[model samples]
Target chain A: MLKGKSILEPMDMTTAELEEIFDLADEIIANPPRFAHACDGKLLATLFYEPSTRTRFSFEAAMLRLGGQVIGFSEPNSSSVAKGESIADTIRTIACYADIAVMRHPKEGAPRVAANSTDMPVINAGDGGHQHPTQTLTDLLTIRRRKGGFENLTVGLCGDLKFGRTVHSLIKALSRYAGVKFVLISPEELRVPDYVRRGVLEANNIPFREVKKMQEVLPELDVLYMTRVQRERFFNEDDYIRLKDRYILDAEKMQLANENMMVLHPLPRVNEIAVEVDSDPRALYFEQAKNGMFVRMALIMKLLGIEVE
Target chain B: MIVNSIERGIVIDHITAGTGNRILDYLKIDTKKNTIAFIMNATSKKHGRKDLIKIENVTDVDLTVLGLLDPNATVNIIENGKIVKKINLELPKTVTNVIKCKNPRCVTSVERNAPHIFHLMDAQTREYRCEYCDEIVSMKNE
Candidate 1:
């Protein structure tokens, strides 16, 4: 049913549709070879308007692993977008060549514009301080694997909640599940946006508490979603420098977390998480990166309507 | 103060005082071509003070824009100086190009051709969210 649909945001897909993607991801993990040829004779166009390492790689790797060919530009300068081509025109041309396309743009809803321009399915890789539904998918799949389900879970989202599109998308996606409480740990400057606070969380009547410190909420959480205070998002270097290291999750802080609590981060992490914390059993971010590819594989197959028995 | 009523035109009444000019600007009605009466800070029985716009010989106005600009305002279509139809204004579910997405990062900001679309997020609060960036803008009359 998700065939030919663009995932511009997490909420665009219903809970049942999310479950379908997750189930397919689990099956792909169990036996990768079964879905290898799922996208054979297919092409995936990666249109990255901004600089990216993991998302672009994960998407290309996913397509390649699924026996599909990949074609795209890593940055806008390499493509006709450098000549000041509009997104609608670029996507219209891309649709002619690629069966499916994924775009990461500097402007929010650029993917939606592209999706509107073409019948070819488009996935939002990441938009500027907006929805990153794929990262939410990766986070959900990781949490599902570690915690079994989303119900009755205390999720701690720490650091840079304001500009973190992944946090907003994940919070909105998780709010649909019952008994999910949030401990929003961020500085006053980087608190969640008003729309996210009032529109998504409070609108759903979900229980949540805003805190300045992470220590108090660490033990209560089933999942700790850490984010970097991105330098790119800030116009002032002074403000970014002051808030970037506000909460560094070292081994000492990890001790306070529950034994079963999983730590997740949409990577390219700066100094927010210590290198020593990566070796901990709770750190699932690296595995989360791998899960990103699997989830995308399932996504590509679903959008392409390529089913495997 | 007495003002002549319009014939084959529209009358907008009960706009929150001090917002009459803004609503008029949104309507984009040409003052040179049409006979327009803009009354501001008029005493009202229900509201202490209100604004009204009575246009003569012009009935074509985007009710959605009017509704968003001033939801409490009432609209009456006049035919031969008699009221024909009255419209009770309500916030529309969706509006296109009425309210610009002020979010600097929104797609509409860059792409001039992109429609400035917003959807009613909370009707109780009279808040609309940008279709692209999800930035909230409340339509509460000041």
Candidate 2:
């Protein structure tokens, strides 16, 4: 049923559909070679209009692992986009060559435009801090794999919650599950947007509390998701410098956290998590990145309607 | 005062008395260039207080925003002193280049080159959303 569907936003996929993808990902993880030739003749077109080495490589690796070929540009300067081609024209032309497409553009709704232009499935890698549904999926899969299920878990989200697109997507996605509470850890200036708080959390009647310090809620969290507070997002450099050190998760802070609490980050991290924390068994960012490939592979296969033997 | 007859023009009727200026401000209508007549605080059977703007040389006006701002505004185009075309302005399907989206981070708010685009998602509710930021702008909020 997910075949020919476009994954543009986190809300685009229902709870049931997300569970199905998770199931597929679990199957793929348990038996990797089973889906090796599932997409043998298929081609995945990765149209990254922005510079994203991590996301582009993840999509390519997902396709290659599934026995599919990858083709497309990482930056718009190298493609016909430099020649003033519209997103519609580029997607339409690429659809002729590729069976599916994954795009990352600086413009919000660019992937939606691409999806509207072509019949092929268009996956939104990231759209100008608007939405990143796959990263949400990666987080969900990581949580499910680590914690066994999503129910009755206290998840703590820290760092730049205001401009963090992944944090927004994760909150929306996780709110659909049962008995999940949120501990929003961020500065007052970087609180989650009102629409998200109203539309997703409050509308769903999900319980959440906002706090500035992560250490206060550290021991209570089953999952701790951290994001980098970029210097660009802050208006004052001094404030960024002052607050940056407090938000960093060193081993001392990790000692105060729950023993079973899993630490996850949507990398490329910029010193938010200490290197010592990476050695902890609770640190799952590396595994989180690997899960991105498997989850995307499940998504690509399911969207393309390729039945695995 | 003096009643002026027009052979051909448009007559906007039933506008709330004090809102006539706001309607003009919204439309950016130039009274200096056009032969325009505005009667303020006029008595009406339906409305206790009303205003009317009659334009002698103009037949068509942009009714999209007018309807959004004031749905009760009625437009009557006259030809040879007889009403030829009558239209009751209604909310448009899509609105562009009008009220600014208040969200500072919205692309439409910061980008001068981009036209402010809004769509009337809930007509009965009278809710409009910025096409770029998806922020709902309500008449009550204005």
Candidate 3:
């Protein structure tokens, strides 16, 4: 049912649809060979208007693993975009050549413009601190696998809540589940925007509390989602420097967390999590990164309507 | 101040006192085509002071724009100097190209010929979020 659909935000897919993608991801994980040829004759075009390492690679790897051909520009300067091509024109041209397209742009809603411009399924990789639905998918998949289900779980999202698109998307996605509570840990300057707080959480009547310190809520959490305070998102370097190191998840902080609490981070993490924590069974960020590829594979298949036995 | 009522025209009443000119400019009602009486800061029992507009032989003003500009404003259809239809304005669900999103990081800010779009998020606060960037914009002075 997700066929030919563009994923612009986490809320675009219903819970049932999300489960469908996750279930497929689970199957692919259990037996990768089964879905290897799912996209045998298809092509995936990656349009990264901004610099990226993980998202681009994972998307490319996902397509390659699915027996699909990949074509795209890692840098916008190499493409027609450098010639001042609009997103609409670029996407419209891409639709003719590729079966599906994934876009990551510095401008918020750039992918949305692309999605609306073409019939080819568009995936928003990350759009200028806006919604990153793919990262949300990866996070949800990791949480589901680790915690069994989303209900009645206290999710502590620590650091840079304001510009962390992954945290915003995850919060919105998780708010749909029953009895889910949010412990938002961020400096007052980096608090989640009004739309996420008032429009998503408060409007949905989700239980949540905003705190300046992560340790205050660490023990009560079922999941701790860590984020880096992105320098690119800030207008002032002084503000970024002041807030960047506000919350770091070290070995000492890990001891205060619940034994079963899983630590997740959308990676390329800049020292927010200590290297020592990686050895802990609870640190699932690396595995979460791997799951990002698998989930994207499933998503590409679902969007392309490629059935796999 | 009593503005002459018009037959076969429209009457927009109870606009927040100071915003009448802005709303009039937004409506872009041609002054040469239709005779318009703009009454600003007029004394009123209901609003203490209000702005009212009467346009002769024009009744097709976009209510949505009017609603967004000033939701408290009332639109009255006049026929033969008698009120035929009165519209109570509500916040529009979506508006296109009415107000530009000020967020520099938004796609609409750079994209060529991108239509400025916003959707109502909080009607009580009159908050409209940009369709692209999700930046909240209040219609007051926009």
Q: Best candidate, lDDT-wise?
A: 1
Residue-level lDDT of model 3, residues B58-130, one tens digit each, is 8888767888888788899999989999998888899888878999899998997788889988887788999
| Tens-digit per-residue lDDT, A161-205, candidate 2 | 877878888998888889999999998978887657865788789
lDDT of 2 at A266: 92
Q: Tell me the whole-model lDDT of each prediction, alpha carbons only.
A: 0.92, 0.84, 0.91
User: Which regions of candidate 2 are displaced past 4 Å?
Assistant: A232-243, B1-67, B71-128, B136-141
Ranking by TM-score: 3, 1, 2
Clash counts for the predictions, in order: 0, 0, 0
Query: Could you estimate the TM-score for every candidate?
Result: 0.92, 0.80, 0.94
User: How high is the lDDT of residue A12 in model 1?
Assistant: 87
lDDT tens digits, residues A1-309, model 1? Answer: 899999999998999999999999999999999988888899999999899999999999999999999999987887898888889999999898999999999898899988888999999999998889999999999999988889999999999999999999999999999999999999999999998999888888999999999998899999999999989999899999899999999999999999999999999898889999999999999999999999999999999999987
Q: Give the TM-score (vs. native) of candidate 2.
A: 0.80
lDDT of 3 at B43: 93
Candidate 3 local Cα displacement, residue A108, angstroms: 1.4
Best model number under TM-score: 3
Q: Which stretches of candidate 1 lie over 4 Å from their true place?
A: B1-9, B14-61, B79-81
